[model samples]
Target chain A: MKTKLFAVPYIIWMALFVCIPIVLIVVYAFTNDAGAFTFENFKGMTSYASVFGRSFLLAAIATIICILIGYPLSIVMSKFPSNWQKIFTMLIMLPMWMNFLLRTYAWMSILEKTGLISQLLGLVGLPPLDIINTNTAVVIGMVYNFLPFMVLPIYSVVTKIDRSLIEAAQDLGATPGKVFKKVTLPLSLPGVLSGITMVFVPAVSTFVISQLLGGGKHMLLGDLIEMQFLGTAYNPHLGSAIALVMMIIVIICLRIMNRFGDGEGQAVIL
Target chain B: MKNMKKIIALLLAVCCVGAVMAGCGSGSSAGTNGEVTVCNWGEYIDEDVLDQFEEETGIKVNYTYFNSNETLYSTLNTGGASYDVIIPSDYMISRLIDEGMLEQLDFANIPNYALIDDQYKGLEYDPDELYSVPYMGGTVGIIYNTTMIEDEITGWSALFDPRYEGDILMFDNPRDALGIALLYLGYSLNTESEAELNEAYALLEQQKPLVQAYVMDQIFDKLESGEAAIGPYYAGDYLTMIENNPDLAFVVPEEGTNQFVDAMCIPKGSENKANAEAFINFMCETDVCLANMDMIGYTSANAEACEIYAQELDEEAAAIMFPSEEVINRCEVFKNLSPEALAMYDALWTKLKSGA
Candidate 1:
C-alpha cells in the first residue's frame, strides 16, 4: 500500500505535463478553424511527405555519425581508471552546460566564409570550407549537440559491464578479436539501440540548429510546425496536425528499435 | 515507513504548488486606479522616455514587450494579459480593427496629436484617425557592401542580378519575401489574386538558387562581416549597420518599396483607458519623441519633434532613413491578407524552401 501511494505524485506529474499536452495535440489535430471535426489535417501530410523524408534522412545521417564517433570515445574512456574516467567524462559534458542556441551561433561564426576556420585554413595554405549554410553544416551541428547524449548512455552501460566475462572468453581457445565480437558486441546491443534512439529523436525534432546553421533554405519537419503556429501562417490546427504526424513517426521508430533490441533498450536507461 | 511516505508526498505536492504560484506571480498589479500597462515591441521605445513619462505623469507605467505582432495578437486573443496599450504594425492594426478589438481613441485627451505629419495620418489601415497614433515609420530598401560591387545598384534588379549570386541575403518571413517579389514585378504588395501571387512565387523560386541564406536579424552580422554582399533590409536598420561597417551603403531602389508604420492604440479590454491615453500623449511630446527616434534610428512621425532635431540630424543619414517625398509617394503599405491568401503564401513558401 505504501509503494502504491508513493507512485501517486509521479502519476500526477506525468498526467499534467506529458499526457495532457498530447491529448490537446490530438484534439487539435482533428479539428478545423471552425471547430468542426475533419480528416483533412491527416490528408494534408501527403503534401509534406518530402519535408518529413528530408528531415528523417538528415537526422539518420547525424545519428549514424554520432554513434561512429562516440562509441570509440566511450570505449577508450571506459579503459581509464574510474577517477580519471570521471574527469574525462566531465570534460565531454562541459559544453552541454552552455545554452545550445549560443553553441550553434558560435558554430555559425566559426564556419562562415571569412570566419575563424577559414582564416586558420588560409594561414595553413589550405582552401576555405564553404559549408556554413549547407546540409553538411546542419548535420555537423546535430552530431555536435547530441553527441553527449549518445556517449553518456553507452558509457554507463560499458562501464557497468562485467570484467570476468572477458577473462572467461580469453581462457577458451578463442582469439582476442573473436571473443570481443562474440561477447562484447551482443551485450552492448541494448546500449547502442538506446543511444541511437536518444540521438535520433531530438535531432529529428530540432528547428533551431537547422535554422541558424542550415540558413533557412532547408525546411525540416520542426520548422514547418513552428511556421504554422508562430510564423505568418498562423494556423494552430494545422500546426497541431503536423505535430501529431511527427509524434506518430517518432513513436513508430521507437517501437521498431525496441522490437529489434528485444525490449532491452528500456533497461539500458540510467 | 508509512509516515515517511506521507511526508515525502506532502513535500512533493508542496513543491509543485509553490512552482505554480511562482509562475502565476504578477509582474505588476492590474491597471485599476492609477496603474497602466503598456505592451510594445522589444527595444522599440527608449527606456529614458519611459522614465520621463512616469516623472511627468503621476500614473505608474508597467511596461512589457512582445517580439512579433503575431505574439501580441495571440496574447490578446487568448485573454492571457490585459494590456492597456499596444504598438502594432499597420497590417495588424487593420486586423485588430476588423475584429473590433481596439478602443476608439478620444482625441481630446491626446491634444499632442496635432504634432503628427499629414502623410502619416489617415493611412489605409486607420483612415478615420480614430484608433491608431503613428509612432515611427520606415521603408524597405537594400544595404550593400560598396567594395564588392563596382556597378551601381539601381533597384530590385540588383537582388536578382546573376553577378551577385551566392552573395545575397533574403528575408526569411513569407510576407516580406513575397512583398519584395511583388514590388520587383510591379504588382501591389497586398495582392490577393492567385495569379499575381504565383508570379511572385515564380520570381522568388528563380532567385532561390542564388541566395546565400534567408535571414532576419542575422543581416546585422552578415552585412557587417561581409559574409554576404547585398541584402534587402528595413531602411532604419541601415543606419545601425553602417556605424560598424563604413564600406556599407543603403539605397531606396528606384522601382519603389514597402513603407510601414508601427502605431500605438488601446485594446478594448483596457481598464485604465484614460491613463493609457495620457501615456500615448506623453510619447508624442517633442523631447520625448526626439529622444526615442535618436535611440531607435527610425524616422519620427511627429512633425514638431522632427523640426526640433532637424539641425542636429545628419543630412545624409536623414536622406537614407527617410527618403524624399517622391520616393515615399511610390511606396505602398502592406494590408492584412485574407485566410485564403495567407494559405497560398504558406503553401508556396513551403514549396520554395523544399525546392520542389
Candidate 2:
C-alpha cells in the first residue's frame, strides 16, 4: 500500500511527459525524416554528433569559467557579516527579476553598432566593433547571465562552514594558504558540485543566448533541437533521439559525481 | 519509506501539472456562438476596429497575435486554435488551399467583395478569388539611411558590396534573404533548380559577414536608431519609418522584388462560420475598409475604400500605398513550390541564416 501510494504520481507523470515524449523521440529517431515509419532517421548520427559536440564543448567551457569566477567570489562573500550576506545574495539573484527575453533584447540594444558602449567608445579615439555576432559575445552573455547560479550554491555551502576549523589549522602550524587549500576548499566541494551541475545542465541546452546574442549564427545543440521542432530542420525524431542521449549523459555525470562526492567515505579528498 | 513516497508523488504531480499545461496550450476556443477569433502578427492590426466590429455586428472578435509567419503556420497546421479567420501571405494561402485546410467562401454573402481591385483577383495563389479575400498588399524593398551610407544603392549588388560592411541589416526570414540573392542571380524567387539555389547560397555566404543583424519586424526600429544603414523591408514599413525619420528613403531595386498580398481566409474547422463571414463582409464594407487602411498604412484592395482614400492621400504617398498600373504589372507574386523544391530552398535558407 505504501509503495503504491509513493509510486502512483511518479508513474503518472513519467507516463505523460518523460516516458511518452522519450518513446516518441526514440520512435522518431528510427523513422524517416518525412515522419514515415522508416529506419532512415536513425541511420545517420551526423546531426546528433555535431549538436552533441557543440553542446558539450560550450557547456564545459561555461562551467569552467563559472567555477573559476564563482569559487573566489563565494569565498569573499562567506567572510561578510550575516546582514551584509543577505544584501549581497539578493544583489546576486536580482537579475532573475527581469524577464529572460527582455534581458536578451537589452544585450542586443547594448551590443548593436550604434549601441551605448559603441557610442561611448567613439568619444574616445577607438573605432566601434560589431561584437554582437561573435563567439566572444555568446560567452559573455552566457557567463554574465549564469554566473549567479554558480555563486549562490557555493556561497550557501561556504557560509555554513564553521570558522573555528580554519583557526585550528592555523594553530597547528599551517599557513593561511595551506589552511584554505586543505579545509575551506574541501568543505565547499558539494556546493561547487551543485553549482557546476546547475550551470552545466542549462548552459549545455541553451539556444536563445547563442542564437539571439550570437546573431543566430552559432549551431549549438539546443538551437539545433529548436530547429528540428520549429525551424527548417523539422526532424523531431532525430531531435528526440539526441535529447534522450543528452539526458543519459547528464545521468552518467551525476552517477560519477555521487561515487566521488563523499569525502568521509574516502582516504584522500581528491 | 513514507518520506520517499511523498517525494516521488510530488515529482509526479509536478510532471502531471506540466503535461496538462502543454495539453491546454492550444485553448483558443473563440468559436463559441457569436464569437470569432482574429489571429494576426503582433501590432499588425488596430484594436479599435474590434470594439467597433463587436458593437456594429454583435460578433465578439477575440484578437491574438504571433510574431512570425512560421509560428502562425504551426498553430494553424496543428489546429491549435479553432480560428475562424486567418490572414496568410500569397504563397502560404496557395499551399493551405492545396492542402485542403481552408474553406471555400460563398461570395454571395460577401457583398463588399466588389470593393476589391480587379488585379488582386487574379493573384497566382487565389487566381479565381475562390478561397480568400485580398486584405493588404505591399512590395519588399531596400530601406536605408542616407546619413549612414550616402550612396545611390540600387539592386541586390548594393547589399553584398564590401563598403557597407557591418552597416548592413538583412531580413530574419529565409525566403526574403534567399529571394534577394536568387533575384541577383537572375533566377526565379521560387527556383526549383539546385544549381541556381547553390548560387544564391554562395552569394548569401559572401554577404553574411557584412550583415549586422538578420531580423524581421525589428528592422524598421533598428533603421530608426541609425544602427543599420540598409535593410530589405516591406515598402509600407519603410514609409512608416520615414514618417519618424525623414532621412529614411525606400526604393524597389530595378531587378524587381516580391509583391505580396495578405489575404483573409476561413479555415475548414471554424465553428462560427456565419459570424466569420459577417466579419469579412463588415471589413470589406466601403467606409470600414478606409479606416482599416488608414490605420494600417497599407494599400487597401477595397477599390471603393480607395476612391475615398485617394483624395485624402497626397499623390506620392497614394502612389506608394495604392500602386499605379505600371507598379501592379511590375510586382511578382510568389507561387507555391513542390515539396522537394521547398526542401532545397529551406536547406539553402538555413545555411544562409546559419551564416555559413
Candidate 3:
C-alpha cells in the first residue's frame, strides 16, 4: 500500500504533463484551424517527405559516429579503477551541465569564418574550413552534445561485466581479439542499443542545433514542426501532425533496437 | 489496496485541477478597479518609463511581455485575461481588428495623438483611424560592410549579385525574406497571388546558392566581424552596428521596402478601457516617447520626438535612420493575408529551406 502511495505523485505528474499534452497533440493533429475533423494536417506534412528523410539521415549519421567513438572510449575508461572511472565519466558529463543552447552558441564563435578555429588554422598556415552553415556543423554539434549519452551507458555496461568471464575465455586459449569479438561486444549490446537510441532520438528532433549550426539551410523535421507552431506560418495543426509522425518514426526505431537487444544481445552480435 | 489507490488517484487529480486553477487565477488577480494590465513586446519600452507611468497615474500598471504578436494573440485568446493594452505590429493589428479582437480607441483621451507625424497615420492597416496608436516605426534595409564591398548598393539586386557570393547573409524569417525578393522583382510586399509569391520563391531559390547563411539576431555579430559582407536588416539596427563597427553602412533599397509600425491597442475584453487610453496618452507624451525613441533606437511616430531625436544624431545617420517623406511614400505596409495565402507562402518557404 505504501509503495503504491509513492507512485501516486509520479503517475499524477505523467498524467498531467505527458499523457494530457500528447492527447492534446493527437486531437490537434486531426483537426483543422476551426477544430473540425480533417486529414488536411497530415496531408500538409506529407509534402515535406524529403525534409523528414534528411532529418533521419543526419540523425543516423550522428548516432553512428557517436557509437563508433564512444564505444572505444568507454572500454578504455572501464579498464581504469572504478573510482577513476567515475571521475572520468564526471569530466565527460561536465559540459552537459551548461545550457545546451549556450554550448551551441559557443560552437558558433569557434566555427564562424573569422572565429577562433579559423584564426588558429590561419596561424598554422592552413585554409579556414567554412562548414559552420552546413550539415557537417550540425553533425559536429550533435556528436559533441550527445557523445556523453552514448559513452555513459556503454561504460556502465562495460564496467558491469564480470572479470571471471574474460578470464575463463582466456583460460580456454581464446585470443584477446577473439575474446572481445565473442564476449565484450555481445555483452555491451544492450547499452549500445540504448546509446544509439538516446543519441539518435534527440538529434532527429533537434531544431536548435540545425537552426544555429546548419545556418537555417537544413530544415529538419524538428525545425519544420517548430516553424508550423511558432514561425510566421503559425499552424499548430500541421505542427502536431508532424510531431506525431516523428514520434512514430522514433518508436519504430526503438522497437527495432529493442527486438535485437532483448534477445540477450545475441541477435546483434551474430 | 485498491481502495487506497483510488483515494490517492483522486487526491492527485484534485491537486492537478487545483494547480491549473491556480495558474488561471493568478493571471487575472490584478482585476482591481484602479489597476490596468498592459502587454507589450519584450524590451519594447524602457522599464523606467513603466515606473513613471505608474507613479503619475496612481493606477497600478501591471505590465506583461510577449516575444511575438502571435504569442500575444494566443495568450489573450486562451487566458481570456482582460488586457488593458497591447502592442502589436501593423499586420497583426489589422488581423486583430478584422477578428474584432481590439477595442475602438477613444482618441479623445489621447490628445497627444496629434503629436504623431501625419505621414505615419492613415496607413492601410488602420485607415479609419479607429483602432491603434502608432508607437514606433522602422523600415527594412540593407546593412553592408563598406571595406568588403566597395560598390554602391542601391537596390535589393545587390544581395543577389554573384560578386558577393558566399558573403551575403539573408533573413531567416519568411515574410522578411519573401518581402525582399518581391521588392527586388518589383512586386507588392503583401501580394496574395500564388503566382507572384511563386516568383518570389524562385528568386529566393536562385539567390540561395550565393547566400552565406540565413540569420536573424546573429547578423549583428556576423557583420561586426566581417564574417558576412551584407545582410538585409532593419534601419534601426544600422546605428547599433555602426557604433560597434564603423565600416558598416545602410541604405534603403531604391526599389522599395517594408515600412512597419508597431502600435498600442486595447484588447476587446479590457476592463478599464479608459485607463488603457490614459496609459496610451501617457506613452505618447513628448518626453516619454522621446526617451523610448532614444533608448530603443526606433523611429518615433511622435513628430516632436522625431525632431528632437534626429538632432541628437549626425546628419547622415539621421537621414538613414529617419528617411524623408519620399522614402516613406515608396514603402509598403504589410497586410495580414488570408489563410490560404499564408499557407501557400509557408509551403514555398518550407520548400526553399529544405533545398527541394
Candidate 4:
C-alpha cells in the first residue's frame, strides 16, 4: 500500500506530461483550425513523402554507423582493467555533458571549407574538406553526438555478462572466436537493441543537427513538422499529424528490432 | 527494506513537487508598478536600453525572444505566454491585425509616435496607423567578399552566376528566397499569381546547384571567414559583418529587393497596456533609438535618431545602412498573403528543399 502511494506522484506526472500531450497531439492530428474532425492534415502530408524517406534513411545510416563503431569499442572497453573501464566511460560521457547545440555548432566550424579540418588538410598538401552543409555532415553529427548512447549501454551489458559462461564455452574446446560468436554475442543482443533504439529515435527526429550541419538544404521530417508549427507554414494540425505518423512508424521499427532480442529490451524504451 | 524505499520515494516526490511550485511562484513575482512582458527578436535591442527603461519607469520588463516573425506569430497564436509588447515584421503585423491578435495603440500614451518618419507611417501593413509603431526597417541586399569575387556584382544575377558556383549561400526561408527570385524576374515580391511563383521556384531550382548552403545567421560566420563568397542578407547585418571583415561589401541590387520593417505592437489581452505604450514611447526616444541603432546596426525608424546615427557612420557604411530615397523607392514591402497563396508558397518551398 505504501509503495503504491509512493507511485502516485510518478503516475500523475506521466499522465500530465506524457499521456495528456499525446492525447492533445491525437486531437490536433484529426482536427483542422476550426477544431472539427478532418483528414486533410494527413492527406496533405503525402506531399512530404520524400522528407519522411530522407529522415528515416539518414537516421538508419547513422544508427548503422554507430553500431559499427560502438560495438567493437564497447567490446574492447569491456576487456580493459576496471579502472581503465571507468576512465573510458567517463571520456565517452564528457561530450554529452556539454550543450548538444554547442557541440553541433562546434562541428559546423570544424567541417567548413576554411575550418580546422580543411586547414589541417592544407598543411598535408591535400584538397580541402568540402563535406559541410551536406548529408555526410549530418550523419557525422549524429554519430558523434549519439555514439556514447550506443557505447555505454553495450559496455554496461558486456561487462555484466558472466565470465564463467565464456570460460565454460572455451573449456568445451570452442575457439575464442567461436566463444565470442556463440556466447558473448548472444548475451549482448539486449544492449545492442536498446542502443539502436536510443540512437535511431533521436536521429530520426533531430532538426538542429540537420539545420546546422545539413545547411537546411534538405527538409527532414523534424524540420517539416517544425515548419508547420513554428515556421512560416503555421499549421499545428499538420505538424501533429506528421508527428503522429512518425511516432507510429518509429514504434513499428522498434518493434521489429525488439523481436530479434526476444522482448528483454522492451523496458529500455520506457 | 520496502518501507524504507517507500519513505525515500515519498520524500523525493514531495521535494520535486515543492521545487516545481517554488519555481512557479518566483516567476510570477513582479515589481511595484507591475511587470510587462516584451517579446522581441534575439539581440534586437541594447541591454542598456532595457535597464534604462526599467530604471525610469518602475515597471519591470520581462524580456523574451523569438527568432522570426512566424515564430512570434505562433507563440501568440498558441496563447503560450501573454506578452505586453511584441516586435514583428510588416507582413506578420498585417496578419496579426487581420486575425485580431493585436490591440490598437492608444496614441495618447505613446506621444513619441510623432518621432517616427511620415514615410514609415500609414504603410500598407498598417495603413490606418492603429496597431503598430515602426521600430527598425531594412532592405534585403547582397553581401559579398570583394577578395573572393572579381566582378562587380550589380544585381541578383550574381547569385546565379556559375563563376561563383559552390561559393554562394542563399536564404533558407521560403518567403525571402522566393521574394528575391520574384524581384530578379521583375515580378511583385508579394505576387499571388501561381504562375509567377512557379517561375520564381524554377529560378531557385536552377540556382540550387550553385548554392553552397541555404542559411540564415550562419551567413555571418560563413561570409566573415570567407567560406562563402556572396549571399543575399539584410543591409543591417551587413554593417555588423563589415565591422568584422572589411573585405565584405553590401549592395542593394539594381533589380530591386524586399524591404522589411519590424514594429512594436501590443498583443490583444495585454494586462499592462499603459506600461507597454511607455516602453514603445521610450524606445522611440532619440537617445534610446541611437543607442539601439549603434549596438544592433539596424536603421532606426525614428527620423531624428536615424539622422543622428547616420552622422556617426562613414559615407559608405551610412549609405549601406540607410539607403537613399531613390534606392528606397526601388524596394518593395511584403504584405500578408491570402491563405491560398500562402499554401502555394509553402508547397513550392517544400518541393524546392526536397529536390523533388
Which candidate number would show the highest lDDT if scored against the true structure? 4
Q: What is the C-alpha RMSD of each candidate to the true structure, in Å?
A: 3.9, 5.8, 5.6, 2.9
Clashing pairs in 2: B172-B215
Give the interface-residue alpha carbon RMSD of model 3. Answer: 1.6
lDDT of 2 by residue, A1-270 (tens): 999999999999979987787677677676765566765555555535655776687777888898999999999998888899889999998998998777877887788777878989989967986697777777777777889999998899899889899889989999988998899988988888888778888888888887677766656768766665665324467566667667777777666766766853221111
Model 3 deviation from the true structure expressed as Cα RMSD, one decimal place: 5.6
lDDT of 2 by residue, B1-356 (tens): 99999999999999999988977664443333468877765655667777788878777787887665556666777567888888888888898889898999988888888878887897889877888988888888888889887788778788998999887888765677888898878888877788988888889888888887677666766899998789898877866898888888777787878899888889889987878888888778777777777777877778878878889878877777776677566567788778677667656665555433
Interface C-alpha RMSD, model 4: 1.4
User: TM-score-based ranking, best first?
Assistant: 4, 1, 3, 2
Q: Write the per-residue lDDT of candidate 4 for residues B262-309, one digit (tens) a residue.
A: 999999989999999999999999999999998899888999998887
Q: Global lDDT for candidate 4?
A: 0.92
**Best DockQ among the predictions, by candidate number:** 4
List where candidate 2 sits over 4 angstroms from the true fold.
A1-15, A33-36, A43-55, A162-173, A241-270, B1-33, B353-356
True contacts kept of 1: 0.66
Q: Which ranges of candidate 1 are over 4 A from the true structure?
A: A173-175, A267-270, B1-34, B55-62
**Residue pairs that clash (backbone atoms under 3 angstroms), model 3:** none
lDDT by residue (tens digit), candidate 1, A8-114: 99999999998998899898899998889988888878888889998999999999999999888888999999899999899989999999989999999999998
Candidate 1: residue A41 lDDT (0-100): 83
Interface RMSD of each: 1.4, 3.1, 1.6, 1.4
Would candidate 3 be rated incorrect, acceptable, medium or high by CAPRI criteria?
acceptable
- Stretches of model 4 off by over 4 angstroms after superposition: A265-270, B1-28
lDDT of each: 0.88, 0.77, 0.88, 0.92
TM, chain A, every candidate = 0.95, 0.83, 0.94, 0.97
